[model samples]
Every structure is written in C-alpha cells, then in structure tokens.
Target: MADDGPDEAGEPEGPDGAAGQPVTPDRLRAFSDGVFAIAATLLILEVKAPAADERVWHALRHEWPALAAYAVTFLVIGIAWIHHHNLFHQVRTVDRGMLLLNLGMLATISFLPLPTATLGGHLRGGDASAAAVFYSVSMAAASAWFTLFWHHLCRRPQLMLPAAREGASRARRNSLLGPVGYAAAALIAPLTPEGSLALSAALVVYFVVGRRAPATRTRVLAE
Candidate 1:
C-alpha cells in the first residue's frame, strides 16, 4: 500500500473539528460593518435642534459644543471603522474565541454615543469635569477592548493570512497606544476638560497620520 500524505490522510483537527478548515470572514466583516454604520448614525441623533423660539444664529452659536462633539465622535468612529477593516483584511479565518473578542470590541463602540452626548451637554457647565472624565473613561474602555482584540489575534497567528502576519505583528505593537493615550486623557480631564479633549484629539490625529506597515495582498482561501 502507498503511504498517505497529510492532506490525503486528513490532517488533525482542533477540538471543534475545524483546525485546518478555512472559514471565510465575509459574514463577520459584513455584520461588523452594519454595527459600525448604525453606531455612527446614532451619534448624529444625539445632536438635538434648538427650541422653536430661539434665534437661529444665537442657538447655533450656543449649541456649538454639541456640533463639535458630534463631529469629533463621528471622526473617532470613522477611524475605528477603518482600523477594523484593515485588521480584518489580514485575517484568513476566525475561531470562536476571535468572534467573542470582536463582539466585546463592538460593544464598546456601540456604547460611545452616550458619553459623547453627556460631554456635549456639559462641556461648558459646572459638571464639565465629570462629563469629560466619563467620556475619557469610555474612550479608554473602547481602546482597551481594541487592544485586546489585536493581542488575541497576535496570539493566534493561524487565524491570519501568511502575507499579513508581519503587518499584524506591527499592528499588535501599535495597538497599545490607544489604551495608554486615552487613560492619560482620563487622568487629565479632572483638572482641564478642554485640555483632555485636546489630548484625545491629538491621539486621533497621530493614529491617522502615523507610519504603518506596508499593506499586504490578502489571499482568500476556499471554504
């Protein structure tokens, strides 16, 4: 009898019987896209219009904080969506663990508008410090989850495409900046809410213009 090769004899499978099987990430990405879109859309709804009697320009000037918050939060969410897309583009398959981690990250993202509205409503009031702190903490939490997601992916290299492995490794290293920066912003919020927000904005700009690993071609596998 001829000797059977690895594929011919069937490679060893994981506990879930899916070790060597290729699972497409299309559905996961699509679902995540929907969540991101909904979350982004929800942010604008938090910006309410002025009362019927108020002068339009006066109301607009007075409500500038809400508009600013909306724009900032929208940009933050948009940037996050971009990062999510880039990260998932490197993935070849997902395990149950990855799915759970991704869900955790998405949960944080969905919860952003609450704190944003709070901050916008209080930016110029006596409670500005508290609202700023709350917003910073919320942002830190989201960043932490995103960092964990990258960490998890790094720990499970098999879930990534070969060409993307190097890029993923670099991303895992860069992911730490988010949690650290947001936490710092949280600490600064109590003393200076505007300064804290400035810091947060700086972090966002850094991430936007930061040097990144070269993009790799994704190789899709058969299901």
Candidate 2:
C-alpha cells in the first residue's frame, strides 16, 4: 500500500498522493470580464444617431438626455467592472454557490441598458418620474446583488486567499453602502427625477474616488 503523504512543499496530497483538481477563479474572471465588456459596449447602442432627414446638429442637440444617460450608465458599469476585478483579486477559488451568485450580479449588469434607454426616452416627458424610478430601482437591484456577493465571500472564508482575509471585514461593511445609496435614490425619484439621476451619479463618483481599495497582487493557487 502506498503512503498518502504531503508533497515536497509540505502541502497534503489528495487521492492517490496526487494533487487534487485545481479550482481557480481564472475562468470565472474571464467570463465576467467578457460580460462586462459586452454590457459596456451595449450601452453605446442606446444613443442612436440622428435620422437621415433630420438636421444633424438639431437632432443631436435634442438627444442630450440619451447622451447623458449613456455616459452615466457607462460610468456605472465601468466602476462596477473595476470593483469586480478588485473583489476577484482576493478570491482564490470559486464554488457552485459563488458561480450562481456571480450570475445574479451579471444579470443585473446586463439589464441596465434597458432601463437606461427607458429613462433617456422619458426624462423630458411627463412620465419622467416613472422612468426615473424604474432606472433607480434597476440600479438598486444591481447594488443589492453586489452586496450579497460580498457577503457570501465573507461567510465562506475558505474561498479566499489567506493574504486577502485581512480586508474581508472592511470590504463587507463597505458593500452595504451601494444598496443603501441606490435605494435612497429610488425613494427620491418620485419627488425629483433630476435629483434621483444626480444622486445616482454622485454614488458613482463616491465609489470611484472615495472608496479606493489597495491594490493586491493576484495569487493563483497551485493545482
């Protein structure tokens, strides 16, 4: 009978004294990056070009709402991608639960452009309140999913690298701000559509400039 022993590096061997199947976050990160890239690209499609018969400059001038919405949504997604990258930097492996939770997050990301278009279409119309509320709610949903994702990682410390553990508690606390801020924006939408939009933009700025995370080296676990 063969002895089951630790390898030369002193890591315990798996079945047959061989290394276990490697479970790394690389594939998950790749898929997420693709989704983020596609979602960002799709936001541009919401900003349509001027009609052929319309005066180009005049039509573009009137499309300011759409243009503005596109820029804001682009920023939202860009910040989301950056945060996602940062979060995954702490992750060493992914399990089934993590995969499902990540899918929920990506679903919200993919859905943002629809509400963005709706908000842009109605921002100057009588239904601005409805459009703005819908957009705010969508943003809140995305933030909620992100909050849940972070909490999941906090709960499952084994999924994270040892070096990353020190920051997990702070990261979990900070995650709550997203859902709360977006929910506040949603609640205020009925009173002031423009204010809701401004609040949403403000949240993006805060995330970008105020909540910067320290850079971490990506450490992959050996197979």
Candidate 3:
C-alpha cells in the first residue's frame, strides 16, 4: 500500500551519522544477560552435601570448599552481568564484528560452570592449587574476551552513542582491571590461594566502587 524503504532524502541514522546497516544491540544484550544469569545460577551446583549421615551438620561443613567456590564465582558472574548491562547501555547498534565478539564473550561465560565445578571439587585436595589456577586462568581468559569485545566497539566509534565515545578510553581501562586482577591471581595461586582470592575480592571492590554511570544512552534502532 505504501513504499517503505531507506530515506535517501534524510540524513543518516545514528549519532555518528555514517551509516551502513543501522541496528539495535537489544537482542544481543538480552541474550548475553540470559547467559550470565544462567551461569551465575549454575555456580551453586558445584556445592553438594556430604553423603547420607547422622552428623548432617558435620557432613555439610565439609562442603565449605564448594560453598566458597560458589560464592566467588557467583559474585564474579553477577559483577560481569552488571558490567555487561552498563556496556550495552552505551551501544546503539551491532555489526558483524560486534556480534562475533559478543558471542565469544558469552561462550566463555556459559562455560564458567565447568571450571567452577573443578575448583569446588578439588579445593581441599592435593590439587587445590591446580584447581585454583585453572579457575583463575579461565576467568582471566573470559576477561580477555570481554576486553576484545570492548575493543571492537572502540574501533568503531559509530556503534556507540556520542557521549560514550568521549569516555571510551576511561571505560576501556576500567574494564581491563578485572582481567589484570585475575591474571595476577592466577600467578599468585600457587603461592597462597587465600591471597589470590583476596586479590579477586579486591578487584570486585574496585569494580563496584569505581564504576560510573553512563553519561547518556540512546533508544534502539528503529530500522
């Protein structure tokens, strides 16, 4: 009934105004959030009660290692979801590169439970250090993937809203802190597991306290 097509007569869409295919990152953000939520929820599976025994309390106490692992990983994933929410809030569009990067990050996020299982099961064994190392290293890899995701956005200034670009460098630096902290923890795991975990907790504190709200955000792409 009506001709619906690109408006050649009007200026381009988006804040950058240099358009290819205008898009909204809403779906990507939503899917990523789902993955994060599922991963966080599944962290608890690492914790299990001891075998059927009359000393129920005593048996449950043996699961403290798993419970500890669950706590750390849960907080880590929870923090990740919050940061991912903030990151996407600045994005208005998605492209092939962005989509691939997002998928890579999500893949690692979804696989987090595997390593969580390993860490929790072995935390009190001879391989405790090894388990901690694996957990920290895996998280470091996830952190790196997330950094690459942000770098993809930084490379394409047009994908983000105007205000986001201005503070992009600062945001990028803040995002790396988690990876750096994880890497450091990985190295320190062999020496002192508690110290390594303490570092991880410190990094979480930094993220929680240092994060700033996005200056502005835009609606999804209508196209």
Top candidate by TM-score = 2
Instruction: Tell me each candidate's TM-score.
Output: 0.82, 0.83, 0.80
Instruction: Give one digit per residue, the lDDT tens place, for model 3 in 137-158.
Output: 8888787866786777777777
Q: How many clashes in each candidate? A: 0, 0, 0
User: Model 2 Cα displacement at 16 (Å)?
Assistant: 20
What candidate 3 gets wrong by more than 4 Å, as runs, is 1-23, 50-54, 210-223
Clashing pairs in 1: none
Q: Rank the candidates by lDDT, best first.
A: 2, 1, 3
RMSD of each: 6.4, 6.5, 7.5
lDDT of 1 by residue, 1-223 (tens): 2223333222336677554543346767898999989989999887778789998889888887777777777877887887777777777766666677778888989999998999889999999999989988888888787677777767777667777766666677778888889889999999999888888888877776665422222234232
lDDT of 2 by residue, 62-112 (tens): 988888888888988887887787777778767666777789999999999
- Cα miss at 204, model 2 (Å)? 1.1
Tell me the spans in candidate 1 whose CA falls farther than 4 Å from its real position: 1-23, 210-223
Range of the 10 consecutive residues with the lowest summed lDDT in candidate 3: 1-10
Please identify which of the two predictions, 1 or 2, would achieve the higher lDDT against the true structure. 2
